[model samples]
Target: MADDKETAEALIADFQKSIKDAFAVFDHESNNTVDVREIGTIIRSLGCCPSEGELQEMLAEVEEEEPTGYIQLDKFLPMMTRVLLERKYRPQPEDVILRAFEVLDQTKKGYLTQEELTKYLTEEGEPFTQEEMEEMLSAAVDPEKNVILYKDFVTLMTVEDT
Candidate 1:
């Protein structure tokens, strides 16, 4: 996976301008930051599909303990870069399903243990039911290791609905 600087540069090269230009579209007040109200519109315009609630979770993740409601251009650029790259490289369904886990896996281990997976599924934004969570766990987790690698998660998520 590309580091933030590499991803930002790639997005800038692809767009032929700084990612700040994209942020400016949402920075209507010209305070150099976009408030929560415009974050979804901005992200959508950049080709992401985070729900309102999910967007809130993303913002919280970015802000961490600070919990800022707005995103500055600097912050938004990196976030957008990651989103674009994930869409560009990861299979779409897998990208969608892995986003929250990616955020939760801040250690960059690229895998989540069953316990970690359980915590994410039960997070406040869109908590999963026990059965749904267990079903997903059974499908994606390695039985021996009791962990879900992102590759496995993607494979499980992209399976055709029966």
Candidate 2:
């Protein structure tokens, strides 16, 4: 039981250390404070940290099993670096909107019906009525009608707060 607890503590420590190392890289590359919450968020996003119950189960398992040497820190460092890069250098507004539209139109059908638009929006937690969607789509659709490309979609949706 004590062994199990030790294993769990060691695992958590290693994970935290990797996070600190990743933050150090980020700090050196771009002068910014990497808050603990950000580390937790990234850990959660990566699906690494187990839930309370899962952690308990792992502890029990570790007690039963022979001790494997401590987890290699290098294996996780690259993944941490990748996550930092993704969050730090996110896509531009136009690129993001364009990718959203492209993803919604995954079939490459060149157009999305009202229902499809609503489904995509709902999945993104940005639900809109058919009428509201039509209004946005109508405004965004180009004259030639080659779908509402990314730039136009960004222009229509992004608001400048006064």
Which predicted model would earn the best TM-score? Answer: 1
* Minimal lDDT window, size 10, model 2: 67-76
Writing each residue's lDDT as its tens digit, candidate 1 over 49-108 gives: 676576777676555356567777766666667667566322256566677678878998
Work out the TM-score per prediction: 0.42, 0.30
Backbone clashes in each candidate structure, one number apiece?
0, 0
lDDT of 2 by residue, 3-31 (tens): 99999778666656767655554343353
Score candidate 1 by TM-score against the native. 0.42
What are the Cα lDDT values of the candidates?
A: 0.69, 0.52
Q: Which candidate is the best by lDDT?
A: 1
Worst 10 residues of 1 by lDDT: 85-94
**Clashes (candidate 2):** 0
Model 1 spans > 4 angstroms off: 1-12, 15-18, 64-68, 88-162
Show model 2 residue runs off by greater than 4 Å.
Answer: 1-92, 109-111, 122-124, 142-151, 159-162
The TM-score measured for candidate 2 stands at 0.30
